[model samples]
Target: MRTSLNLKKVSIALLVVGCIVVIIIAWLNSNRYLPFQGAETTSSGSLKAVEKRLAKLKQAGEKPTLEQLADAFQPLGLIDAHNHNASSSRYLSMLDVWEEYHIDKVVLFGDISEPSAIGTDAAAWKAYQSSPDQFLPFFSGFDLHDEGSLDVIRDNLEKGYFGLGEIAGASTYSPIVSLAYWKASDPMDGFLPEIYDLIATYKAPILLHIDPPNGLPILKLEQALEAHPNTTFIFAHMNAYNSPEEIDRLLGIYPNLYADFFAGFSVYNPDGGGHPEIFIPIMKKYPDRFILSSDSGYGIESEEQAIDAMYRILYLLDDPALAKKIAHDNMMAIIQAQPATMTQLSAIQELASKNGKAYNYDNLSKLEAGKILADAEKG
Candidate 1:
C-alpha cells in the first residue's frame, strides 16, 4: 500500500513540472503577457498598455530569441527612419513582418504629428499601432497652436516614444505630400523659436526634412544646432545636393548633422533609382553619420523591398562592413544611444552652440501635406 502511494505522488509531481515548463515556453514565444493587449490585429486598437508590458518582459528574461525576432525581421539592427501603414501604397505592420520577413524591431515616426494641422501627421502615426514591436515610435509635427502639444508629447514620451519627427521641417515637398513643411509659426512673429523652445522643454531630438542650395533649410538650422548642440538632428531624404559640390559643402561644415539616402533617390527618380554616384561616396566618407530607412511600410512591395535595396550597398562599396554600418549599424547605435537624462536643464545643455541667435527664423508656416510638397523634392 505504501509503494502504491509513492507512485501516485510521483505522478502528480511530474504533471506539475510539465505544466510549469509549458507555461514558460508559451510566455517566452509569444510575448503574451497581458493577453497580447494593444495588438488589435486592426489599426484602431489601443497600444499604450501593451507598450508597458513589453518593457517588463524585456526586463524579465521572457524576451523572444534573436532568431525568433529575425524570423520576419531582417538584420538584427535596422530602424527605418521613413515608414508608414497609412497614407501610402503599403501598410506593413509588426505581425506582417513576423509572418513574412522576421523583423524584430522597427522604429516608427508618424510622418506627421499634430492632427489639428490637417491631422495628416497624426493619421500616419495612428496607423502603426497595429504592430508595435517592429516599430520604435517617434513623435511627428507638434502643433504650437495648441498649448497641449508639449504636454501631449510628454505624456507619449512617458509612454515610451523614441524620438521626434523625421523633421522634414519647412520646405519638404513630395508628389504624395503637398507640404514642404509643417504649419510652422508665422516666420515674422518669432513663433518658430517658441516651438523650438517647447521641444527643448520636453528634451527630444527633431529630425529636419529640408536640404538645400543654402546647405540646409534655413540659416536658423545651424543656429538651432549651435544653440541646442545637445539636440540630435536627422536630415532625411538627403537629396539637398543640387550637385556633388553641395553635398561636400554641407557635410564639411555640419559634423553634428546626420543624413540618410532612403527617400533621397526613390521620390526623385522612380524610373531609374537613387543617384549613388553622388550619395554613395558621401555616405562612405561619413559612414557614422548615415542611417538606413526603407522609407515605405512593409505593406507595399516598395516598402518591403527597401531593405534589400539599401543592403545592396554591400556589393557597391569598397568596404562592405562600412556600407553595412551606413545601411544598418549606424542607426542602431543611435537608437541605443539613450544617454542618461535627469533634469530638463541638463538636457538643454547638450545642444551645440552653433549661433542660433544669428539666424532669421521669422514667420515660416508649416503647410499641409501634398499641399507644399507637390513640386518640392524630398532632398
Candidate 2:
C-alpha cells in the first residue's frame, strides 16, 4: 500500500514538472517573436548600451559601415519621401532592392527637361504604372518663364501625377556643373502666382530644392506658405542642411512646411557613429514634420544599401515610435491625405498593361523608338 501511494505521488510530481516546462517554453516563444511588447525595459537598456558602445567606437576612431550600424537594430520597414527615378534600368533595379529591404513606398520624381530619358517624367509615370502600389510620382517643374510650362503641369496633373517638385531654387542652381542647370526664377518673379495657384487648387504637395544664401529663400518660402496654406511644401535636403534649431523654428512657425533628410550634412554625419545630439531634441519637438529619404542618385548600387543607411541613422534616435513616424508613417499620412482618384487608377492600369515588362530599359536609345513603338503598334 505504501509503494502504491509513493508511485502516485511520483506521477503527480512528473505531471506538474511537465506543465511548468511547457509554460516556460510558451512564454519564451511569445517574448522572442513580440520583442517590442513587454520589452520596453530591455529595449531601453539595449539602446543605452549601444550608445555607450558607439561612443567608445567614436573615441577609438572607428566608424561602422551603414550595414554594420543597421544590423545592430531590429529591421523596420521604410517609406522614402525623396528619391529620383534616374533611368528605366536603374529604377527597375531599385524596385528589386526596395522589395528586398521592405521599403513599402517611394516618392519618385523626374526631370522636366529630359522627358524621355530613363530618369525623367516619362520613366516615373511608367514605373508608377508598373507598380501602382509602390510609387508616388511627382512631376518636375519646367521653366516658369515658358508659356507651355503651366500647360505641361496641368496636363500631367490631369493624367494622374501626384504632385510637383524637385523645383530648383537658387541654392541648387550652379553654373559650374552641367547637371545643376535648372534654376528657379527669383521668388519675386511674377510667374510663381499662377504656379502656386494651380498647386493650391489641385491640393497637391510641392517639393522645393531650396538652399538659400543669407536666408533669402526662407522669406520667399514664408510668403508662399502664407499665401497657399492649403498646399504642403516639402523642403528638400532639410533646407540645404540648415541647423536643427532653424528647422525647429521653421516647423514651429509654418504648419505646411515639411522637411526631408536627404543631404550628407554633419547632422547626418555617418562618421560620428550615431544620431547627432542636436537633431534628437528637434526631431522629438516636431516628430511629424520630419521625414527620412535616400536622395541617393543613379550611382548607388542598390536601393537596399540606401535604405540601410537611412535605417542606420534612424535607429540612432533610440525612440522606436519616433523612428517609425519619420521612417514610414509621416510620408504615408501625406500620401493618404491625397488619395488617388478612379481616373488615375484606370490610367495607371492601362499604362501597366501596355508596358508588359517592367525592367526592359537596358538601353536608353532603343527604349524610345523600339519598345514604345512596338507596344503602340500592337495596340
Candidate 3:
C-alpha cells in the first residue's frame, strides 16, 4: 500500500512538471511574436537599427525604398492641427491621402482674403458638410478695424464655425479692404483688444501666424499673450523662425501659448535629413504644448508626400508615446476640450448645405482603394 501511494505521488508531480514545461514553451513562443512590447520598441536602438539598414543599402550603392524606410518605424495616426483646402481637387485628394495614412482628423483653415477665395470658410464648410467627423473648420478674416468684418466673423462663429485664424498680423492681406485691393497690416496694429475679447467670448482657439526672428512680431505676440490670458493661442509653424531655445523661453512665459509643428525652416533642413535633433528635445520638454500639422494645401505636391515628411520628423523622436501625443493626442485633447454647442452644429449643417458641395464618401473611398491596390501591386 505504501509503495502504491508513493508511485501515485510521483505520477502527480510528473504531470505538474509537464504542464509547467508546456506553459514555458508557450510563453516563449508568444514573446517571439510580440517583439514590440517594453524596451525593445521604445529604445534608441530602434532608430539605430533603421540607420544601420539605410547604411547597408548605401554601402551596396542602392537607394533605400519608401517601403524599407516605412518598415523601419511603427505606424502612427495623426491629427493635423493646420491644413488648407484651397480647392475642391486638393480637398478631395487630401481626404484620400488622409485615409491612406491613418490621419483621423484635421483643422481646416479658410482663406478670408479675397485674393484666394478658394480656401475660404465656405470651402471648409463644404468639406465639413461632407465629413463632419473628419474636419474642423476655422473662420479667418478677423478685422478689428472694420465693424462689418467683425460682424462677419461673429455671424460665422454663431453659425457653427469651429475657430478663428491662420490670421496673420505680418501678412500682406487686410481683414478689411479700404480700397479694392488687399492692404498689408502690421502685426501690432492688426491684433486689437476687441479681437481678443471676441475670441475669448466665443471660446474658440486662435491659430495665429506671426513669424518670429523679428523683434516687433515677438513683442506684439507677447502683448497679445499677456492681454488675453484666457484665450488659447496656437502659434503656427513652431513660431516659424524662432530657435528651440527661444520657443522654450516663450512657452515658459506664456502658459496659454501652444505651438504647431507645421513645416518651418528650423524644423526641416534643405538636405534630406529632418531637424529631429533640434525638435526632439523641445518636443520632449514640452510634449503637451506641441502638436503636428501638415500645413499642406494648394502648393503641396501630394498629401502622401506631406505625410511622409511628417513621419520623417516623427521617427527622430526616441519616445513613441511622445510621438503619438504630438501626432494625435494633443490635438484630440484640444478639440474634445472645446465642444461646440447644439446651436453651432445646427448652424454648421445649414451653412454646409448652402455651400452646395456634394460629398461622395463612397466614391472617394473606392477611388483611394483602387490606388492603394495599384501601389501594393507595384510594391
Candidate 4:
C-alpha cells in the first residue's frame, strides 16, 4: 500500500511540473506584453501581433519574410519622424506602404539639396490638402544657404507649415544627395543659425542631416544647439555615422536636440553593420530622445521589410512604454498642436488686410492662418 502511494505521488508531481513548463512556454509566446497594444492579425488570423512575427524571425535566425510583417500596424501607430520624397509622384506610390505599416503620421518633405529631386512648397501644401490628418508637411523646398530661402521659410510658416527640414546640412560621400548648390559648411555656418532661431520662434522642429558624423560638423551641431536652445534640432538618422556611445553622450548634454532613429541604417546600412540590437541600451537610456524613421524607404526593395526592421528595433527595447515612446509618442509630443506664434499670426493678418480680408486673427490655428494666406496669395 505504501509503494502504491509513492507511485501516485510521483505521478502528481510530474503532472504539476509538466503544467508549469507549458505555462512558461505560453507566457513567452503570448503577445500581451508587446509595446503596441492590439491584437493585429494577418488575413489568415493565425499571425496576430507584430511581437509574434518578430519572435519567429528571432528564433529561426532568418531575415524578415514579407509574410512575417504585420498586415497593419496596431492602434499605437508609428510616427515616421523622418522621410523624404513627399509631395511628389514617388510619395503617392509609397502611401499604400504607409497604410500597411500603420505609419500614423510622417514628417514629410522633399530633397532640399539634389536639384533633380527638390519638391516645391506648393506641391507639399497640395499633398497635405489631400490628407491633412496623415501628413506633417515640413518646408524644405529651397537651398538652405540662400539668403532668399529665409523669405521662403517665412512665407511657408505663415501659410501653415508643420516645420522645416530633411535639410541637407553636411555631406561629402553620398552621390544621391549632392550638395553642390546648398550644403552648409557646418551646422552653424552662414545663415543657418538665423534659420534655426526663426523656426524656434514658431516652435517648429528641423531635421538636419550631417554625414561623417564626427569632427567639425558635430562640433558645429553642438554650437547650434547651444545658440538656439529653443529650436528643436532633430539630428537625422541618429547621426548614423556615429557610435551608440557617442549618441548617448550627445543626448546627455543636449536638451534641445533629438534623434531620428533610422531603423534601416541600424540593420542594413554597411556603416552600422547589420546590428539593430547594438543601439538597444543607448535608446533605452534616452527613451524620449530617440524617434524611429526609415530614411525615405531607403535601399530596401520592399518598404514592408523596412518597417519590419523598425519593429525589430522596438522589440529590442524590451519595455512596452519605452517602445511606444520611440515608436510614436516622442515625435507626437514634438509636432502635435504646434501653434503659430503671435508674430507669425500678426504677419499673416497684415498680409490678409493688404489683400482686403481684415478679420480678427488672435485665435486662428496654424492651419487656418495658413489657408487664409494661401487663398489670399492665390486670389
The candidate maximizing TM-score is 4
Q: Which candidate should be chosen as best, given lDDT against the real structure? A: 4
Model 3: residues with Cα > 4 Å off, grouped in runs: 1-76, 115-119, 142-144, 172-184, 264-274, 297-303, 345-379
Query: Could you report the Cα RMSD, in angstroms, for every candidate shown?
Result: 16.7, 12.2, 11.8, 14.8
lDDT of 1 by residue, 186-279 (tens): 2211243554654554444556556342533446666766665555667655643444466556567777567755632443345324555546
Return the lDDT, model 2, position 287. 88
- TM-score per candidate, chains pooled: 0.56, 0.66, 0.66, 0.74
Worst 10 residues of 3 by lDDT: 362-371
What TM-score quantifies how close candidate 1 is to the native fold?
0.56
Query: Clashes in model 3: which pairs?
Result: none
- Which tens-of-lDDT digit does each residue in 1-379 have in candidate 2? 9999999999999999999999999887555422111122235555555566555545666566654444443333467788876457768777666765666677887563333322487777777666665677787746665667778777777566777867764453433212444456444344665777776665677777765523676788778788778778888767344677788878898999888875234334443233455576887888898888777532344445556657655756766667767776676666545534334444444666777634222222211222233344346
Error of 3 at 64 (Å): 7.8
How well does model 2 score by local distance difference test?
A: 0.61
Model 2 ranges off by over 4 Å: 1-76, 112-119, 172-182, 187-190, 267-275, 297-305, 339-379
Clashing pairs in 4: 159-370
lDDT measured at residue 283 in model 3 versus the true structure, 0 to 100: 81
Q: What TM value does model 3 have?
A: 0.66
